[model samples]
Target chain A: MVEVQALSKSYVGRTVLDGVSLSAPQGAIFGVIGPRGAGKTTLLKILATLVAPTAGDAFVAGASVVSEPLRVRRQVGYLPNDFGVYPDQTCAEYVEFFAACYGVPARERAALAADLLQLVDLYHRKDTPADRLTPAMRYRLGIARVLAHDPRVLLLDELTAGLDPRARVEARELLKELSSMGKTILLTAPNLAEVQDLCTHAAILHAGQITQAGPFDEVLATTPPYRTIAVKFLGDVRLAMNLIKAANGVVDVQPFNEPASPSDALAGVTLLKELRVTFDGAYADASVLLRSLMHSGVQVVSFAEEN
Target chain B: MRAPHLKLPALELSPIFAKEMAGRMRSARAYMVLTVYLAIVSGLSVLLYMVSFLGSPRTVSGSGAVGTVVFYFLVGMQVLLASFVAPAFTAGAISLERENKTFDVLRVTLLTPAQIVWAKLISALGFTLLLLFATLPLFSLAFLLGGVEPRELIIALCVVFASALMYALLALYISARSRTTVGATLSTYAIVLGVVIGIPLAALIGSSTVSLALAPTSGSSSPLADLFDTLLTLAISLSPISAIAASQRFFSATGELWTFTPSFTGSGLALTLPSPFLILTGVYLIASVILYMLTVRRVARIEQQ
Candidate 1:
């Protein structure tokens, strides 16, 4: 439930965001992926109503950012990429403080803070000082703090920037759960792979402009059609190479070498050779190719597509 | 037809106020400051009592003089303490939010800019009032000796409170305009010192110059002389210390709450002036409102930065 129409923001003579437009449907996880300094954070800030656009306007939950910023603020919760916590406040107090700021009745604030902390998996640390928590926990606290007001739209800037792999996966799952609960989420990431599986809709922002925006698959479709399939195997490298070359939709095959992974070595398997095969085909066709290779009696170690 | 129903907005305590107060009061620093302030005032009160009364023969008139000395000393210490600590309380109110990157998060909330500014201001002032009120017993020492009137004591406390308020608001305004806590604090103290020291210094020089210039026309009524007198009164009122001293002088001279100025030359216009305490209080209240509005505007414009 967010619409940005030709939003442009500039400072001095330099443009930070230029004519950027995108729409996020209600309950959809929309991701704006870009490299550092590509204006993803700037775009989200405009939607969050923390920064005014130099030109044009954005609407969050039907309120214009320019004309009705207070109304927009009421409907949107923003989590900045980097923020500090009140060191003296307990985690629950931090959340409750924001709850009060949102005008939640004082009597209900304690219960609400508890529920929000539980949602973010931080209930155990409710009484801990916010600044004393680990970075990941602090990030979760930020999430809970944003949810205190139960806004209709959430603008999360670089949601997984500094998270560990496990925490990143958990954050992705949380975003999915939030989407299922009918919350409109607009998150940013430094790369597409970070949000590829999680975002229902995605946009590629590069140099203050949107190069691509749409359904996740549709955006991927706009890219080059060639896909690289990596195959690792144990025995008869030549045979596996031959099989890969014979597969349907195989455009090219290149043999490569790498030491076996610790897991493979620990399993007492050795002499693994990897091959990179460029293939163009549908999902079913790829599956058939895999089955034919297996039927040909090549001991396949692993087969996966490389983004 | 029935008149339309008018709904007054409900009063709600600001979350910022609640949060700031809880954090500030819970910290050891608040109590440490309170303890040290009371200790100093207490020690000084005892020292002053001994020096003024016990150092020589005890008499009714002597006790009264001792009480007056003790009372003025305590009040002077209160004003000095407030001037020093009030700015420290608020100099980081907004700038620290910016440094910590919480400004945007707070701004995105439903609280209005005015709410944020006023909440911060009131929270700081609340702590300052606590520091002032903590010394009530020390003030009662002067009262028990029977020299200081209740009205005088109350008016003196008002002057101290108003000065603290002015200091706090000035710091908050500077905090809203500054990008860093250090910068805001330094700027606030600089301006506070200038007002405290420079204004009276400038008034002293100006009045002297005016007197010398009007020496030839001393016996006659000149508008320049009257204007200079008005300016002198205002200048003295602006400085809290001078205002306190002037208020005491006014009280002892008239034994009235307020009085008008009579012309130095009877032939000239008789200018009506409120007592220095009233003038100081009025100026502080008005300046506080203006500073509050400016701070609110500055906060509202933070998005542009």
Candidate 2:
């Protein structure tokens, strides 16, 4: 378990982490989302015992980061955004050194190193030096290095950033597997869609503070009531715009920039519109408007939900 | 059952010392230092043999071979190598870690600051000593020439070893405090050179004035020169190069580290003893330890966000 009690940090005169508090229970994947420069990294570093908070306390597995950093380090594994790995050391040599630093016995180091390499799927690249490893492979190596000690808590910062789509998907799968093994995972990411898909619980960070937090469903429910829907229309955009403007449920109508509302590309017609409905849990409101549009003989080619 | 959780001890971690030493030992720089040391030793040996083979066998009054050219050559090598190589071995020890960005990895480990510092100091110079010991055959072979004594060889090695320790500590201390290897390397060189060259020269220049003021009746140059030279040499000897100058003070017939006096007019000259290099080297050793400990403290508490 990890608890951050009103944690705060500052560099020079500028505050980074304002009095923020959070707790991650055993076996939970807690994702933190924020835009650039929102202090996600600072909070994670403090929890890792890499930096001290200007004020407040962070405890990892019941060990205070400030007072018992060694104990804290032993329990929490931190993977920084850049994932600094020593350039010259090969993957196996790198893990071996960390295992030694972690004071895993000399006899057990090779086995542990092999296990971590296999876990990260870098067993094939074990002989390659860190500088030669691809960014995605480096990220895997970073994860493996952290887990070499078998820590209870993982403070992962932007694990999927800089990775290609396929790599990101694979990384997400690995995280889910680690989370299932009873590891309390604290993840930070910039991709909101990825956050929504992967996070069981998440907090939206803004301007050095968590603006909204909880399980995905709870956070979504508490966030401003806004719903978006997409529609493909069988006519020029003028016809779709007029139909959306006259609709009972839709509050905002915007044209979608696809299958351009030109007569040339239309089977009969081709246009798409994105509609935002300002309704608080009213499914009938949207259904009523769709019925009214269809009754007007404006053929709705396709419809779907969106952000 | 599990033996323990998080039982890693701060003192037990190797940090990067072993790797650094291993890497350094394999570098051309290590071989260069060894080569230079060996060249000085052998070149000096050959030069002395050439001079002795041609020149008349000399004596310091009644004591035969006490002030032989052979004795001075062996002692010269010990001092020259200590002054030249000790700083080279240590100056980049910790700063290289900073330049390479590996200091943070070592710092975040369970290893305490002092342990890291100790490990660095030891590993930086340990390989150099191993290389130095490899030349034992060459140094031992110097004994076959017969002018050198077993005790003198022992004392020379002791002085050389002691000087190396002092130089290593001083250089390591500088490496720890500085942000770059260049800074540590340059500062150590400057400081070592100052001790080796600056102190004796300054004292030599100042001694005449000091002597004239202290005793107007004495026109004796040796009194001023010897007095100031001994004191200046005391400081110089504090460096590893002290082994250089003290190497000249090989065993006399009386088994003393003393030299016979120059005959003063009318009165008998007193035997002047070379200042004990070990005592000065001891002071340097103590200072080096204190500096190393200070470095360990600073290294341990470093944290970056």
Candidate 3:
């Protein structure tokens, strides 16, 4: 329900988002992951119709962000990274106020606000002032406010940043529930790991460019099919390496070392050099290599995935 | 075939207007501000009553000169105070949205730019009117005392409201331009100073210089002098204080609230123009509409890019 084409943004003399493009299909939980200053927020703002791109355009729910911002706004709900609560306004009042802004009839706002508050699990805090709610609760109320108009697409910037682990999990679950309801969600995060478990599709941005963009599994699976296995050998490292090189699916082997301790060197200790094997295979082939190393009488101290 | 455009239904009260009114009414600060405003006006009225009537019994005639003095003083204060209060209420209207990061949310709403502007204007003006109405008894004292007429009271009210709107729109315009609440408030006060104090002073200086320079030759009859005097009068009329003073002067001279025809024959453009109250009201309302449109344009630009 959201599509961006070669979107670029610049502020003064500095370029923030450079020719970035991505799309989110209907009901998909798409995430944009990048470090700070990677233009993630800028990209999201452009799609949200809050910021205009210097070049290119974005469309949400068939509305061009540049030409039909009001229409885009009608179909999309944007929760900015720094979303704040109005002081002295209760949760229900805040949601009702937004519902009113979206032109929800006065008679319907109460029930709508109630339903939205329930969706965000903030029904209990309905009467509480928005500022009195905890940060996570306030964030949830912001979500509830955005959904007050029942938008089809949600453009959230840093939707989970600064949340406690439990709140984060709850927010993820709520997003999942909403996505299941066919609300297309596009969000930005600081790291892939933050959204890896929740997002079906994600784009990794670096230095204002999309470095990698695809389905989660597809992107992760395309990372060279190379696994570095670190093995600590106590004796006959050469034989172990030679046998691993001859093993099935073994691509390459190299000796790796952890920096030696001065105390160990001074104590005449002969530290075992680490062996790193580049293996391209499934679990069965890795098991076979381990068995062969064991049968070869090579004493192995440790074995682990390098990364 | 061209598709027909469908417009959204306009709400009688904007959601922003309702929200602002609700927020303002709920805050203790609003009540405290009102209390302080009432207290000051009450104190001034009582002091003026005592000084005008009690200090001199001979001046207490059936003519109610004391009432006139008190009325003028109270209306002057109302105009001046509303100027300050209106800006204080509205200068931060938009900038506070930016501070709280809600401007984008507001823009994306179905509320049109004009509706948002009206919301800010109406809410601020509503509070200002509330404060003005709270002093109704004091205003009634002027009428009860007999120098102030119902007609003059109504005219004074119209002028007060128009000036309040002018100041509020000024602040909203500044608010739309500023990124911070403090910056907008400060800038609004600066503009307020220019309109309330600076403009009248400049007009006085300009007119006096023109009069003094021509004093030796023409003594206020030359066309150049007439033109300068007319321009100065009109410029001075732009300030509410000057407008109220001129209105009071006209009321005292003609014993009428408004005079559409010139009371005296003169060869100056100023003499043919409308009363200062009418002129100032028209100028302020027109300027306010222009500024409101400019604010809406700025907001639309922000939304588009």
Candidate 3 local lDDT, B1-305, one digit each (tens): 11112234464477777788888898799899889988998898878887888655654474387888788888888888778988898999999988987788788787878888888889988988898888877887887777777777766777888889989999999999998989999998988889888988888888778788877664645666766666676777788887777677777787766543342226433344677788888888899899999999888775332
DockQ of 3: 0.19
For candidate 3 chain B, the 10 contiguous residues with the lowest summed lDDT are B1-10
RMSD of each: 11.0, 11.8, 12.0
lDDT of 1 at B169: 93
Residue A236 error, candidate 3, Å: 48
Tell me the whole-model lDDT of each prediction, alpha carbons only. Answer: 0.83, 0.68, 0.80
Displacement of the residue A155 alpha carbon in candidate 2, Å: 2.4
| Each model's DockQ score | 0.20, 0.14, 0.19
User: What ranking of all candidate models by DockQ puts the best one first?
Assistant: 1, 3, 2
Model 1 lDDT tens row, B69-135: 9999998888886787888889999999989888889988888899899999989989988988899
Model 3: fraction of the reference interface contacts it also forms: 0.45
Give per-model TM-scores.
0.82, 0.73, 0.80
- Cα lDDT tens digits, model 2, A10-56, are 78878888888877788888887664578888888788777788889
DockQ, candidate no. 1: 0.20
Candidate 3 ranges with C-alpha deviation above 4 Å: A223-307, B1-9, B55-63, B203-228, B254-271, B303-305
DockQ of 2: 0.14
Model 2 C-alpha lDDT per residue in residues B78-197, reported as the tens digit of each score: 555566676777787678777765565555566667766777777866765765675566554345545555666555676777667777778887887889898898998898788766
Candidate 3 Cα deviation (angstroms), residue B77 = 1.6
